[model samples]
Target: MTAITVSRAAQIRFSPGQWLTAGLIVAFLGLFLIVPTGTVIYTAFVERGTGTLTLVNFADFFRSELFVRSFWNSVYVSAMSVVWGTVFALPLAVLTTRFDFRGAMVVQTLGFIPLIMPPFVGAVAMQLLFGRNGTVNLLLNDMFGFRIPFMDGLNGVIFVQSLHYFPFILINLSASLRNIDQSMEEAAQNLGSSGFRLMRRIVLPLAMPGYLAGASLVFVKVFDDLATPLLLNVKDMLAPQAYLRITSIGIADPMGYVISVILIVVSITAMWLSAVAMRNKDYSTVQRGGGGMARRKLTTGQSIVAYGIVGLILLLVLSPHIGLFLLSIATVWSFSPLPDGFTFAHYGRVLEDSSVYIKNTLIYASLAGLIDVIIGSAIAYLVLRTKLVGRQWLDWAATAALAVPGVVLGIGYLRTFYGVTLPDGTPLATLWFMVVLALAIRRLPYALRSCYAALQQISPSLEEAAENLGATKVRTVRRIVLPLMIGGILAGFVTSFATAAVELSATLMLIQSNADAPIAYGLYVFMQSAAGRGPGAALGIIAVILVALCTFASHYVLERSRRLVEQSHGTRH
Candidate 1:
């Protein structure tokens, strides 16, 4: 917060190395984030054909019937998505946190599984199960001679998004519930509140901060999603329209920039709304000598009901993974309760035809993750350790990426880097290297948070001691601070890599050659063809495994880090 003045020791602690590092960070942020964002804002107000600054782009966008419809559709779908996200998350958070129940661990794990897979990856499989001519529809037709509009048009976007993103709500709510004081519950129960009524009136209201945080996050994510809407053949949404305008028409489309501006505005508004909602509320119910929320043991009837509810939710949540597996091996699955046949031929076919996508994903995502760490570590050090001017601005700028939709970023690159050609006369946007850069830009926020957190745990006295012992500032960081924070840095890298591997919206636009596409783009390509889904499912399975392995590895590293921290404290004691 407060700027540090240059004292004798402070001047000695700062070095040429920190100066150079801070300069590089500013340059990197400006080049990647500030430039593209500035370009978008500038171009949105400027007409391309006349090269004149005017508001006609906004006026024309307002006049277009399709654009108006798309604007409302995004608003309507994102609102519905947040509502469903709560529905899916609240009960599960309640059951797992407030009661002792069977399959509690399994339920939590299942709730998370949906999030590991991108909704677009499962859209095709969901179609096979809930599409008009798919298995579920066929079964319903035979049983009751009617079908539900579960996957119809924009409804499909809401359905897939609710399932995929509800984990945000569950995770945040679970934490809030855990930190709640037992005295509040006791007081409420003493006043004739019990069971669901107790939770609804007291517990839920108190957890509003976490609930609103997760809900706003879901709204922002759903509003910015491009792949899910495209997968469902619903292109009227703002994100898809932006992509279509940029790539399908031309890079000079001002309307695309206008859409990007709107997306950014909407995302920022959602986050602001969350903050505003929680601003004046006093949620502190903790006591100086507080106890805990006693977990109630379920009665036989309660146990059965809880298990039934959890099982049904798990089935619904896990349908994407199950559907993907079944579809991957199915020979012919149309209009049938089961596939006519099963085989590994799809996996074989994909491996034989195009395994390069998988390899490219690994290469691009890994490198992007590495780049994230480099910048994350630097920014963390500057913000936390050094007295660099406006260091907080670096952190703020990176976090701002969360609100910048991938599709918007993609279009921005096209606009900013237009006509920039490579050595081979190929455009810069088409290069695999640019995709890696974009991925790093998009994921740096995650890694930066992790690194900043890790550095916060280490005391500055340690670094000062190292400096007093004649260690240079660079050596102090390399030898003292980094060793302590390596575990968190590793976890951050894995998270960035896993997320980047599944990224589609940005990758789809940057990829000019089919040969250079990543696994997510491959998944999209496969789903486009009736015969290609089998192979797509096989690819989807591999992507899921990659992410799961990374998640487990991150957990392991973090656990090991905690142990190391405990051991260090023990030594100090």
Candidate 2:
């Protein structure tokens, strides 16, 4: 029997339906992702029009002073954002995870609020509150006879990005802290280490994996960001330069392609370094009974200090949201600590004239979310439950989208698909459906991860039992596997939908008409003018509400599903 099993495993077998599903997935990814990205890379390396391979494009990139400066500027801004992010996140993560704090849950909950709004949307509000001649600076000058350059040049970019991206670190590090076995810390205390010294020597080292993961993510996201820097009018960064070059100089220019190649390299390198840093390091020491590291109780004086620290941080964290709300209602709000006047006219204006943006967002995000869950489910099943050859390659290909910047993907789509016209002779790249595809591709990795996690929690024996009872694979997946995985699939869809709704980088490159624009694009357009700031802020708030509702709905669905499953088990037992 063992010999027969081994021989059977060595051979490939699939039903017609399985073969069809696999073929369709491969074709979709190859046509939309691989071919377009390859075109961009190829354009960077080959001679224009002649198609002859050459190194001149890259040589020119390194030799140009502007491009070199832009490269270094991006590096500098990304590094500084990570540093500031650590300062903002480290204390919150430690206090909430390792100490007995009353408001820990609140801190954790509010910390994620920044992520709901895009950093660029917050960038304008940050300027109103933090910029020179803005609210804070005006107050400081009046009281202290001096002003600080919080939103001056690159400093502005770093400040806005750090505040927005720091939650990534906080969330990852908190989870890591909770997973640390208490035995290690107790062992360190046995050796007379009980304070900050113990944390530095033992706890932090164990949590290094989470720290690096979050920090590297922050770095990549900031580096790939296009709208924030452009909104701040800091155009010397790589992403903005790529957008400007491609849009202003047309697709024929090699500079944009070269910069895109460099962006891909940096993104890959950051993720690689994070992985290499954790290589061969076994920090997983959670024993069966080890819930987590024991928490320390704060003394009375310590409580006051901790609360004070949290209060100050919370104020900074909520500044953007507050400023945005005030700006939305204010008739005039320049150089004032508060809005000159408040009104609901902006919201009314948005509802009356900008309903198209909201409608389009609902349609596009829903379609993109639908596409993600389907592909994510298929890929997850193929990799986990099948013996198909090269099955793992599908997972890798889907995940590799994480390293491809949105702008790079947008550029790739433009170059690869612009020539293919519709029946009306319209360029395929200019169509609105291309926007949905770009969003789906950009967000696929996230959904795939969710599906992979969902499938991992199921026991293989259940599927084997169904098959032994003569159930077909299709029927089993539909009736058994998918129903069980619905919670994760819904979670993935919400994540993809929320993020895709606010995504502006790729859509900025692809949107060819106002009628096809989503909320993010409309927000960007409104934000560019002083007269439109109120309406733009109103739109931003609406986007936030939409995402918040979706998040709540997902949680409600998951809870309801859990109760239903428990009731079914009770009846069966």
Give me the candidate number with maximum lDDT: 2
> Per-residue alpha-carbon lDDT of model 2 for 1-573, expressed as tens digits?
999998896667766776787889999899889998999999999887888999999999999999999999999999999999999999999999899999899999899899989899999999999999899999999999999999998999999999999999999998888888999999999999978899999999988888999999999999999999999999999999999999999999999999999999999999999999899988878595347889899999999999999889888988999889989999999878888899999999999999999999999999999999999999999899888878899999999999999999999999999999989999999999999999999999989999999999888898889999999877888889999999999999999999999999999999999999999999999999999999999999999999989988998998999899899989999
**Model 1 residue 216 CA deviation in Å:** 1.1
lDDT of 1 at 364: 93
Task: Count steric clashes of candidate 1.
Answer: 0
The positional error of residue 147 in candidate 1, measured at the CA in angstroms, is: 1.1
Candidate 1 Cα outliers beyond 4 Å, as residue runs: 1-14, 285-292, 564-573
* lDDT to native, each model: 0.87, 0.93
- In angstroms, what RMSD does candidate 1 have relative to the true structure? 2.5
- Candidate 2 global TM-score: 0.98
Root-mean-square deviation of every model: 2.5, 1.3
lDDT of 1 by residue, 4-113 (tens): 55464564465677778888988987877788888888899998778789999999999999999999999999999999888888889989988886677778887988
